[model samples]
Target: MNKHFYQKCIASALALIMFFSLFAGANPAKAEAALNINADGAILVDGETGKVLYEKNADSVLGIASMTKMMTEYILLDAVKKGKVKWDQEYTPSDLVYKISQNRDLSNVPLRADGKYNVRELYDAMAIYSANAATIAIAEIIGGSETNFVKMMNEKAGKLGLKDFKFVNSSGLNNRDYKGEQPQGTGAEDENVMSARAVAKLAFHLINDFPDVLKTASTPKKTFREGTEDRIEMINWNWMLPELDYGYQGMDGLKTGTTDFAGYCFTGTAGRDGKRFITVVQNAKDSSGKGGYKARFDETRKMMDYAFSNYSKEKIVPKHYQVKGQKTIPVIKGKENEVKIYTKSAINMIVHNGDEKNYQPVLVLDKKKINKDGKLTAPIKKGEKVGYVTVKPKNGEKVSFLTGEDQIQVDVIAAQDVEKANWFVLMMRGVGNFFGDVWHGIASTVKGWFK
Candidate 1:
């Protein structure tokens, strides 16, 4: 080949390779395989930040089964904390609780017709054993009746920012299980329902707002009415407990649910190496399409494994970090024309490995503190919060927090003080601006004439 031809060929080949490399970089290989979660609905979230790490059909409302009790637990705990109810206060079993507690078909710790169980005892049975009757007794103590408790559940769900949920009863049982004696405000066939996202949110708040609940939830075995003739062994249904046959390390205080309608469902939380995750699996099944206790835990384990192996809590945006082109805001009538601003705290979020660069910070200033042009008034104090900063994916991938409203955020504050200019200085500046505007107008007119 001629020398010139050889040179041209080499350049063409180089160009082709560069083009392909750019194309490949633009559309990088998929980071990892989609999690193989076997469930109708599922979600995995960082326990600390509520950042959703993985999800499948998480918004579709489905039967929550006994997971509904987490809400009841939240309310009861709040009541106890606020002095609305006492742990030592005793509750007399009503006819409904008495009858339901005796039913062997349901998960119950058989209550005596004349029994006066304390709130603490009933709470243990409900939290550890998923005792339906015990749950109802606690609900009655708080809401005065199961019907009222259902209202409280829905109300609290709204306040907690849970989007998809319906509470027909304090216990998660289908209303039909009530045998026509269901709570008054619900339909005969209605069952407690919530989306996987909402379930995870509930679990998140349950553990965070009331960490003590885990102590009771982790109990594998407790005797109801211990030392009494009516005492019965209550074994926790959560097989993932560290003491159980299918135990997983770091597993603690969570709930499990199963029903013909809801199949097998679980809301599980585990922590390892200072990182914790909350996972929810609804209608979980095995390879053979079989739903069982083990199936729920298996599916949950899959998600948990995917999270711990592939993701980590990273300080995506460091404290005092300033956003480009937004590091300062113009100050009106100040010693300095502008004030430097930076994040008040670091933004730590759960992120997939290799995806850290995908996120960017967004600044939203407080409207009341700034003018329409985003200029701040004079006399701004150092470290004063002017707005907030939230993180969003640069690639536009949807990022959802456990609570719909809980986007990971930190405060944006002024980095330095901006004192107001003296009145004489302000007056002189105003005169200068007026003259400058007059001169600029005259110059513009002259330029127009030339044009």
Candidate 2:
């Protein structure tokens, strides 16, 4: 029996290997973080459409650990955007930042006192190494104290329209007061947590808002000095940076973070053929001294592999192309008449081997099933919703995403369906209602009058 069990195990392993080898890129396995990645929240999206491809507990609120620095970089970049600071701007570690670094917090690039560091040096240090000191210096240099810097972080979060997120610290570290105790939910606290989806969205906005950061964050390794101080060499913490051929070398600039509470989190992007994909994974196990980090990297590679393998930007339907009949639908009691819908999302689909024109399509709408009459009942105004479609492949799950198909809402007031209210049509409806009302009214009136 033991021998048989061994044989089965060996056969299973072989089968798994063969499966991977055969179906390497067939369809992206619903992106579940692989073994060792016990992260509770995660998301994967196409960089082009910003459409989420897969998510698990994405909006779930959880501590983000040091991943908070991504926001720090964003705020600093905003300053640069406002011309408040130049790329070569000289920023010095303030007395406040120096003290924080002296405490030797979770992650810091210790800056020596009596020395000045440029913005570029600090940016690279924090970006490549997740240095605690580097982050504090940036906080102090940007906003006088990490406290003020943290407020700036919240402002940026607000600007990003982050609904499920709040900023308490410039770093992902837990908030601590002067006594080295955790602060309880007040004033730029470090207890800020966000869902995986929110973090991904934040990362996506950063990429869109500041594409330049990647040039440094994506570096495999770099060495730099601050004001002629000892040179610090730092390497990226994202393990995925080296494993995949296409995603690795071309990939640039992002943040990696980990803490006992937040596990490991990484947000990064890579481009091929001018098409880029931004990926966010949180709570990934990062036992660096152990072998857990590799699994996280492997999972990222798998997601990227699936995205590039299956999706390529293709225009499924041209703008203003009549899909069914009309452009808009009527929606009563809604903000607008008929809601106009169109797919601004470029259908990123992969087609091969004579399967070009064989794509079968179906549309679906946001409104619930309607049976008011055989068709949509009146009251739908211009810009009111109707339905959507499912664009199915010949062999697989239907593709329900199209630019104009899903948004085929009716333009209620675009033209009057009344069509001069044909006398015959009005008479039939009026007669049906009049007889029903006459009988009910007589019964009610007789009962009331008798009483």
Top candidate (lDDT): 1
Off by over 4 Å in 1: 1-33, 446-451
Candidate 2 achieves a global lDDT of: 0.61
Q: List RMSD in Å for every model shown.
A: 4.1, 10.2
lDDT by residue (423-451, candidate 2, tens digit) is: 57568767988999999999999999888
Per-residue accuracy of model 1 over 41-152 as CA lDDT, tens digit each: 9888889878777778889999988888899999999999999999999988999999999998999998889878899999999988999999999989999989998899
Weakest 10 consecutive residues, lDDT, candidate 1?
Answer: 23-32
Clashing pairs in 1: none
TM-score of 2: 0.63
Query: Against the unseen true structure, what C-alpha lDDT does each candidate score?
Result: 0.87, 0.61
Residue 316, model 1, lDDT: 87
Clashes of each: 0, 44
